[model samples]
Target: MHRIFEFDDIIYAVLQHVKSSGTDLVNVAMTCSRLADSALNILWAEQSSLAPLIMCLPQDTWEVTENELGHIVHFSRDPTPIEWERLRKNASRVRRLVGPHGFTDVLKLPRGESFIPDLDVSGYVLQRLFAWSRPATLFPNLCELHFDAVFSLLECSSKYWLLRKFISLGLQALRFDVIDIPTHEAEQLLATLPAEAHGLRQLTVSADDGTMALTVPPSLGKLPKLIGLAIFGIDVCLTRQTIANIQQAWCLQSLKLKLCGTSCDAGGIPLELPSLKTLHLSDGSLPQCTHFLRQVTTPKLSHIDIRYRGSASPAEMTAFIESLSTSCQTGGYLERVHVIDESKIPDPLLIIPLSSEIFRPLFKFNRLSSVKFVGVGNFNLDDGFLYDVPDAWPSIRELKLTSWKRRAIDSVTFTAMMSLASRCRSLQTLHLTVDATQSTIIPRAPDGTEKLWPTQTALRNLHLGYSQVSEVARIPYFLAEVFPTLFDFKWYDYYCGHYDDPDIAMISALSALNDALQELWALRKSAGDHDLDERWEKDSDDSWT
Candidate 1:
């Protein structure tokens, strides 16, 4: 251990690859005060409730007793000057909190921010403590405050005053986690946000689903540093004026919201977002999505993740796609597009088979690398679409088009899928549903000689989701012919519920495909192939987990 200080460069090099956790980390932390302090500081930072910290005051300062429901904490008496100073010093170190739990109820504060979460801290005790300091001791330098209460703050309530007190200019993030505020009150709180915290960067207001209609206050857009915003609500949340104001936000980059039901007003000024890059919308109808796409022009946009919660006609889908194409400037900058249909229940209106024509608008974004569409499947993908994809997205890496429930929509075939292998040379992960009912077909030349089919050597994973596959015995060879370097071949069964129970047929199919790969890997391994192990260490996977 003394050698750690002797050679600092050697220690740095050794520490880079060392994996330490649990008792190993605890034992190491116990060796020094600095490491122990850091570990305690991290644990105390995310403490969730103030109950634990409040107890650290002088022994007689707070009394712990029991009630009908649970234990409670109340001030025994006023803290003396020295005791108060001791409490203040320790409490000030808390930078962020994610709770209020049962603390507010015991404090007799239905709306008071003073109410501690998950603990029965007395109301009178908090009132006296906060009253002692104008800015409030608990809130002086809090960068983040997350409330778990279903609180509604009326103007005269302590919750409102405490909320205002907590909203200092230094605060960076705030979240309303537990309660879904009514439209008027939500607007009131949002309206007050910018005035208090001009440096606020991220804001999240969550509800169960789209049941609550939350609107963005125009004042929210005035925050100079506000970059990320996610609100779970219906279409009414994004008013025309709100959308217009959002376009003018040069600092804002990512926005996530759900759209559904009716909004009396739907149009927004055609405003441009110069720095906007990632936009995610879910529970949105096709018309509303098309409307949303028409409202904003984001030249720097790279990723668009959207979900159709219910139904849409082919024309509506096409119109939405067209609007999306127009909204994003397609000088080959767009990188990812994920379109999903979350309607688990089947609907006659939702039985719209997806055609390549609906996606043709995206051809302009030639640099698109990752494209995914799930459960919007009733695939009618044509040869032209597959043939043109390599030309359209030459550098494509991941393409997933899958539908598990509706096996009735499979039209794409193996021959058509093979066309992509020649051009999309860098393709790695593919999730496509193809008509594999005729699984015995072999690739042959025009003159009838046995021809070698084009194989994608870079392809690692092939996910055939509920696609028809007969003659299972011969399918492995067929897969090996298409993807020579494939590491995982999944046919008919998709990987969704991999842990709940084992499927016998899925296991059999996986084993057969793996056997086919063993022959393919035997030659590569003899030549020193360690691709699989090395590929797992991606640049983004920096943490141990």
Candidate 2:
């Protein structure tokens, strides 16, 4: 090694070999002064990780070290109390410090245990490094500070005081996660946030309970630099005027609302968001939310993700989607729309329009590139959402359908899917999920008869439950057609017709899908006309116990 280092060419070759073998150069240098000095020179070129190490070093050593040498150390682990004391002494050099888990007392709170805490892991490091002068740790010069225990602050304790301290740090981004909060307490907390912290650019507040309602303080609307805001579990009976008041915020750009019920009273006046770009609403009755959206006139909006939870009629659901689509086109603001739900409500009212006629007459999502329908079961499309697809969605290239539960997919749903594919002229990829062992079959057109899809339509990707083939096989033979463009196929619990044990079949199907995806990817770059034969072989191989 020493001889090789005599020449640049040989040294480069050795370094390349070591790098390729994944050996750490630092460990090698630790063996000798020559290599250590060389490695130190290269490593010291980037001084970002130096502060924490200097803060943790022995007090005597820190006092003797030159200012330039402060960036040479790295902490072996999260700060110990001694290291924290050292940091407190040399607080000015402390710019960033990240701590190990449970650095603060916030973890004792119920919300922290059940949900999330606001303690910024890095703040621990900062605290230790600047322990000598805690005030110097303030974020006037700091750019990013993450505290995970903010959600636990509602409780009365030192943690609450810590939260207040964090807020005063002049952070640009804040994330508060928790499971639940009393409505009145949440309102008071929001109202208590010092108005001067208006410099906040991003805010994310989440709760896990779907049934609990959130009562956000109207003072939230007064934030000046608030660009992004996400609020979950906000199903209170908010007046339409209140929504308008919040929308009137000049700088808000991204908004996410998780509603538990259908009670939004956006006054009859149209709510307008001129600067908003992205919107996500989850857990609500589609009909009620649609009416609420009609009052929203956001011309600059570009993305929307809507998730329905309550039971509503299919017609109402379709009309809701249609109305939202029309609003997007008229404002020329929509680029993507995603609908997700976990409810398996079987009211023909909810399913019919979404699957069949509702999306037919409307212009295809011209500006939209992605669309997702998740957790759809007992879905019907005979009336509207399932009508023959429209051509307006020329820009749509990817589609995803995700459903849970075994009975979410049915024969009618699959047949309607074929109709949707026939209309997506520019569609490049599609994801279809069937929950159980059934698959729908679209029969071949009669001989000499013209049909929209005379043969099976091509899909780039397909995901089905193990029972998809068995269900589709029940149909006439002429209806069987492989996806011509299929490159990837996944099955969850895919089973052969003869599996004696249902549980085993599910496990087998899951295994087969994983294996198939891997094998296909391995062969993706291979040149071959053996696509059909290869797929069949792969599927057959997966069925083996």
Candidate 3:
């Protein structure tokens, strides 16, 4: 009796369900001679998932023993040479392999001996696989690689040599996270690399403390195509010097500096960069920042973003911005300054006075287009001098104000915003944050009603900072009443309570707002189904572009 088989349909179904490695197809083909012949030339072993299948085999196949299997079952639990070879043949598709456990303990080879037995186990497995599959040439298609920074590799002579050989491949991107290296060795490795390797267009060097400084090679600055440079943990002074050392890097356009030591002295260094367009400075100390400003002279500079620790007082922050504006006037064409936060330090006495002085000069710059203040509190706008801020920043296109303290902003206090809207007619975007904690201090609008923010003629983007998720639920009404032309809106929960503990209440509020938006979107999409009113959908649809 002949059994019927749906060969084409079976093949299609097999391909559809072959989500794991091709190991399943190989096993199925082994069940029958006919199946094996049919599956020939399937190229199932070329599957990308093959390496994981091979790596997991040692954990599942509990049949290899050290004494019984000799060399064949070296990695297997219960030495079975024939079975090992069968598994090896099926698993050899894996060109590159990673071990679950890294090499440790130096593989303790006997003195003067060429090889250690367990070390040979790893090499033999890889060698047999490579020999059977001819994977050496296959690795050219591979461009990314990852490896655990094994501790033993640093001290083990054999492993260290092998590591060097393994990593010298033509890799485009390599990320070695938290791989502790001796300071001297790390320095040597970086110092010895030839700068002419044209393939490495982007390089990231990161370390956490004790690892030696991963100095930027002077040769790297000379690379014709290098455009991005990110350096972390170097001394602030050293970082400025290194950047100055590569001053003529015309290709360099993006820079990110997270300096660790004392801020560099700007008195001696002439801040200068001719081609740089983007600069990110994360310096915690403001006094050190003056030096940084003195060194930057980007004629085409369009963006400057700052992130520093919370130690700068409002006064010092004012100085920092002044120095930045001064830098642009001297050597750069600074167009936009985005301070992620103004108060690098929490000293309030410095913040209030600094805000007054900075706002006065800040409003005078026509080249400055946008300013974003994160975690900035203090300065009473009710004061008559504060009313001139909007006019002072005539060219200001976007303004973001985030509050760390709760204070009442009365319509009477909105003279600055009104002045900005009326005088600095160039203002197109405004982001405002109001801390609800000052509810008790800031007198409520009459009759228990919420007051709408002052209206602006050219407002397009508006962000509201609310104290709670519940407060955000009132935004649609808030926007409709005060900002009819608003094209974009975002709300952030500025958690203002003292507990500082994990507060799920804030998370729940955010989740609820997210759910509300998702539901609104779903409703808008379904409006056409029943010929229900679609005006809301059309009205809410924004087409600013």
Candidate 4:
């Protein structure tokens, strides 16, 4: 006997199968009335643009013309006669409105002038669209709205008011690119935001031009529900009162300041953000960053990414990390740290050097899972650095130490590699430049006997730079013996050539390594060791159990 599935159950099953195919879901909706309601609901939930909905209007209400560029131009004298009932049915289902082009087609239609002139029609079209959208009935369920290009709106107050109306919809996330608002207009925009958008959780505002610095209104600090704020190409001056207002946003978790200039009053107090968890700063001056760090206290901060343009001194960078360590010592632990140098100097060695001493303070945070040190210049790591890494950061899973200068690396021997594998058993991804030019074989026991290497069951990805393939020819076999679960191995000359070049010695070593690994896997399979397959199949938590 066949059991009948409920309408909701059928829709759920069909949706699961067609989750990745929008076309299939639409077809299902068109197949029958019962499935149409549910399938259409899913199809119209996140609209990339309002063009499809606009096209649903009766053809009599709009006119289409062809331009010289062979592009279809839409001209509608009036959108008021549109079937409101049918439009509302689909519009209400929309949860996300992403306008990477800022609703150009819908907003740029020609009106009033039946004899279209050869001029810019965007202004006239936007004026009409603004009048139509001011009622707020177009998108009742929109929780997220993104505008990729908003330069047209900044020119007129009517368009700006329309923007305010959308903001008053109480959206969860609002992202817009290239907003160049005057100080007074910015104040007006900020005033309506807190009262109208109290539920806003994420806000991103960026300047239209990099050279033109947009001023951030202090009233933006009143956003009570804001948890993530990213501002780019803007100048934000923090006064004592402004800092206090920002500190009141207790729910803020992530803050990213890129190509942004932030300053405080001469006698203003420092900003304190105790609840922040992730912080990223890029393309700012050393003094600006130093002053900002000195003022802010982020006890809950766990992830930090800082990119340098060679303006920050090594001493300043060290001091900033030390300050974060001190502030988070009570109950907070840093999990990821990234330091990158963006200066693309002709001579890589001329770039600023970040010594191992600068990273010593990071050892205090024992919970670190990933640490990346990227330099266009040279990064100096002492011989004993790897020996202490396993103990200092036992939970480390991803480690990358990349530099252009190979001469900067020193004292990397085969024994050190064995020690790292043995100690950091949870390591899965590792990229390091090892000075293995002088070594030709794996390290032997003190009495010249064969040295036994510990098996690394968790390691899967390994990359070594600036190492001669002839010198470390046995590396693949050693890795296969130690890392039974290993899959990817990359060895390259950091300063010069590719590892995939036609070298007979390298090819032979790689072939022998593959044979050894396959033999080892065969032995494990015959011995009824299914644990290896299970470990590789299942996704285990980073506890390394």
Question: How far is each candidate from the true structure, as Cα RMSD in Å?
Answer: 7.9, 10.8, 12.4, 7.6
Question: lDDT per residue, candidate 4, 174-193, as tens digits?
Answer: 87654545656756766677
Return the top candidate by lDDT. 1
Question: Where does model 4 exceed 4 Å of error?
Answer: 1-14, 59-73, 76-85, 99-130, 133-135, 149-159, 212-221, 234-243, 259-270, 344-351, 408-411, 440-451, 468-473, 491-545
The regions of model 3 sitting more than 4 angstroms off are 1-138, 142-179, 210-215, 263-267, 329-336, 341-353, 359-370, 376-398, 408-412, 415-429, 433-482, 485-545
Query: Candidate 3 versus the native: TM-score?
Result: 0.55
Per-residue lDDT of model 1, residues 249-292, tens digit only? 57889988766466435575567877888898877665777787
Q: Per-residue alpha-carbon lDDT of model 2 for 1-545, expressed as tens digits?
A: 46656665554455443332212545545766545544432322212232323534554433221233221222345445654564333333332222222122211113333622222223343344444444324333433334343122223333333445556436566665444445555455567653746677777666646656654556777777888888776653663644655674678899887776646564575767778888887767776568667767777778887777655556776777766765554534577777766465544333332454554533444566777766544433341343433345656666765444433334345455565565565565566543223554444576955443534354555555432333332222222333345554555553323456455545544654565455555454343535656665555422110
Which scores higher on TM-score, 1 or 2? 1
TM-score-superior candidate, 2 or 3: 2
Error in Å for residue 343 of model 3: 9.5
Query: Which stretch of 10 consecutive residues in model 4 shows the poorest summed lDDT?
Result: 100-109
What lDDT is reached at residue 54 by model 4?
54
1 or 4, greater by lDDT: 1
* Model 1: lDDT of residue 3: 47
Per-residue C-alpha lDDT of model 3 across residues 354-448, encoded as one tens digit per residue: 24455555554556678776664454333344356554555778776655543333212222333344455567776553332211112237797
Q: Over the full model, what C-alpha lDDT does candidate 4 score relative to the true structure? A: 0.62
Residue pairs in collision within model 1: 100-117, 101-117, 102-118, 111-159
Model 1 worst lDDT run, 10 consecutive residues: 102-111
